[model samples]
Target: MNKLRQHSFLAFLCLILILPTLVFGECTCDEEEDGDRNKTEALKYKLAAIASILVASAIGVGIPILGKTIPALHPDRNIFFLIKAFAAGVILATGFIHVLPDAFDNLTSPCLKENPWGKFPFTGFVAMVAAIGTLMVDASATSYYSRSHSKNNQAQPVENGGDEEKAGEHEGHVHVHTHATHGHSHGSVDTSPTTQLLRHRVISQVLELGIIVHSVIIGISLGASESPDTIRPLVAALTFHQFFEGMGLGGCISQAKFKARGVAIMALFFSLTTPVGIAIGIGISNVYKENSPTALIVEGVFNAASAGILIYMSLVDLLAADFMNPKMQSNGRLQAGANIALLLGAGCMSLLAKWA
Candidate 1:
């Protein structure tokens, strides 16, 4: 394990050092003198993007969480499933339409050499590996927590068992209570609400990680651009993008039932990440060339990995789990409604890709 950690750290360091050299072909650093009007327009768009995305994200997340107060939006209702299906579709579209395409464009840019870079499909490969890695982490974490919980439960007798055992002792019938206790233990081992809740928590955290990575990268790109034309359309598109993405994340976080503090932290973090990335980009814009080999490689790799994680989580954890549930399967009308909602979400998000 130690060796594995060491190797992983070394690989990360090497990537950081080597990314700048991936292409020596050309740098699209246009040094054209833009008049003060252009500068003012760019600043206007940048601020607009920041404020719009921030408000959109906050409203998106807040709606779902606050929806708990509305009976119609309760998790147990069919409407909730439809909402979740829509959110899952948005996430699926984001991974496939937004992040994956960006990854491919970056890795296959004309600026890169045709030797080794063009020889292999790094974008697809990285995405595949990242998806498999997420599965492994998901499986391992679930197993570890389940096993630990089982062991802890075993170490302590059930509350009912203690009362039954005491009665059995008083009545000189300990064997009867022992047998009943065994049956209860078997049932507890088979299924538990705590275990299910823990799994949701894990899914929520991993999903947030994937979403935040892509969000920050997009923000940086938007911030670094000096082109007012490019920034103009992006501001509107990314506002909608952040809003939909936040809804997806909010659903997961609501299901996870995190503490008040945890929910606040996550919502704030999601709301602030894009703005923070933009801030970082503005600060480094003088040296941050978007077309630079380092920027391309890092952004491409991260985007690909994020795509994989989001896709897997959307398909396996969110959509499949809900679609296959007894509640959904039993109600054909509900299922059909959810399917339509899913398509609508995917279509809306896909359309945004045209500009973003």
Candidate 2:
């Protein structure tokens, strides 16, 4: 009888422990059902944001591509130099002001452990590495292509009988420019076609890489946020962001003179990366913790690398190349105009940082 009593007591204790779980499980189910309803409501906002994103993107990218039709916007026009300069300034500001700071924030977030990340500025270090790597790639690529071009030129003899007629007529006066990067120069007119083509190819590919990296990141970040208020402004800013960036990229592509197929492929790639990123964010929104360590690390690293590439490309390839030209140096008014444009571009992009 005493053992029987003990068994009853044990069962009573188990019931007390298990009863709360059973009650809590029902509450959990109700909460989950409510959450589903909330999520469904949230979808309405997301769809609107996405639609706005597409429209803004279309406007932004279309303008630059259409600039070819505008008389003042031709690549050879003097205004084009100033426009490119302004775009370069915008890119530079983007690297330094926007992306780098965000990277620092991410890498130094409190969520990340303190031992390694907090000890030093990983943002700057990663950016520096990326910049150095870009330089190496830029130099090596130019060398490889230039060498191959030279070899091809050598193999194919010049037309008009070895081009032996009247060297003085075209000597150093053909409106020919090198645009050769990384210690390469266009010394001989005997082989300019190959050099020009190669330079354009390099510029187009590099520009795309830089722009696409930044765009996808911003797109996903915008899409994944739960706050509708935040998404609204970003929709506008990012639209303009893509437009200006598209213009910059379009300028490079236009200069590159790519084939129809190549141009379309590049344009489409630029357009899709951000949208794709947004979709990815939406799909992963359930498990994607914005404040999580893994998310911070990946985002921080990519931002740093992107910051480096844009900084280098803007300063070396865009600003310096155009600013140092005889045309710009000779015309004070044009120089002033370009400086103003630079400020405008930088200001526009800087303001957008609030949302995106």
Candidate 3:
């Protein structure tokens, strides 16, 4: 009887250990299956995103360019001012609400080593340095072009200014003197059409660079995600995000009035960047871990830099230039309209942040 009882107790102990092992093994297999299924679903959503975003970007940018054919949408028209104001607001919100926060999140992620990343506010520091660098580039470019154009203006006679060559020379001198005085007084003001056009070109190109950086980062992120639920909502959110951003870029491009070939190239480049980034992400997804130290640092620094460029361009080049214009200041109705449009643009972009 005693031997039988001891044997029974040993059997019970074995059962207790074996039962948990069997249950855990079954759970591990189920988890593996679920992970595979999620990856498959995510791929499908990523493909859909590439297509939808491409279409949305094309339409958004095309609208402003096509609007140039309409009289009311002319750059000089009041309606154009309102449209530009709205676009500027969109850019502002993108920098502050979308890009800047992402930078902070990435830089401060718990996955990074606490010694360096956690010890310093790298995001803010990088962003501030980037902003200063952009300002330097902006000022230097403007000054160089201004001087070049001023020299050309001095050397060449105005077509309608005078008759005799001596009169032309006198007129050129007078014009140069006047421009120099104006520039000195206003601190880099150039009212000539040629100079204005050059500024627009520079602004458009720089703005595109800023937008493209953020676009590519976001695309890679969406593509690398293995969660179908996360990718699904992002598809819609990013579509709107790209559309509005394209509109902002389109407005600048239209104002620059690039030749047909140039315009097409710029538009095509903007439209393709995100899709290309997605492809890259998909190719590397198997090896790409978002929480890795290298990934966090790279994404965080790039995001911070892009945010700086966009914020500077939107506030200094776009909003300030337009809002402080004599035309806007002189007319109360136009001012009100532009203000409303700006708010609406910003609010729309900010709302999209909920999903993206």
In order of listing, the candidates' clash counts read 0, 1, 0
Which candidate order results from sorting by TM-score in descending order?
3, 1, 2
Q: Which pairs in model 2 have colliding backbones?
A: 60-243
Per-model CA lDDT versus the true structure: 0.84, 0.75, 0.86
Regarding lDDT, does 1 or 3 come out ahead? 3
Worst 10 residues of 2 by lDDT: 167-176
Note each model's CA RMSD in angstroms. 15.3, 8.9, 5.3
* Candidate with more favorable, higher TM-score: 1 or 3: 3
Q: Candidate 2 on 1-356: residue-level lDDT in tens?
A: 99999999999999999999887756778888877766665566667666766666566555556566787777778878777777777788889888899899999999999989999999999999988888787767777887775565446444555342322124322212223322555466434655555665786688679778877787778667765566667666766777677767777787776777887888888877787777777788878889999999999999999999989888876777677766789999988998888888888888778766
lDDT (Cα, tens digit) per residue for candidate 3, span 94-145: 9999999999999999999999989999999988898888888887887787
Write down the worst ten-residue block by lDDT for model 3: 167-176
TM-score of 3: 0.85
- Candidate 2 overall lDDT versus native: 0.75
Give me the overall lDDT of model 3. 0.86
Model 1 agreement with the true structure over 229-307: per-residue lDDT tens digits: 9899999999988898888888888877888999999999999999888877777777899888889899999999999
Q: Give the runs in model 1 whose Cα sits over 4 Å from its true position.
A: 1-35, 160-191
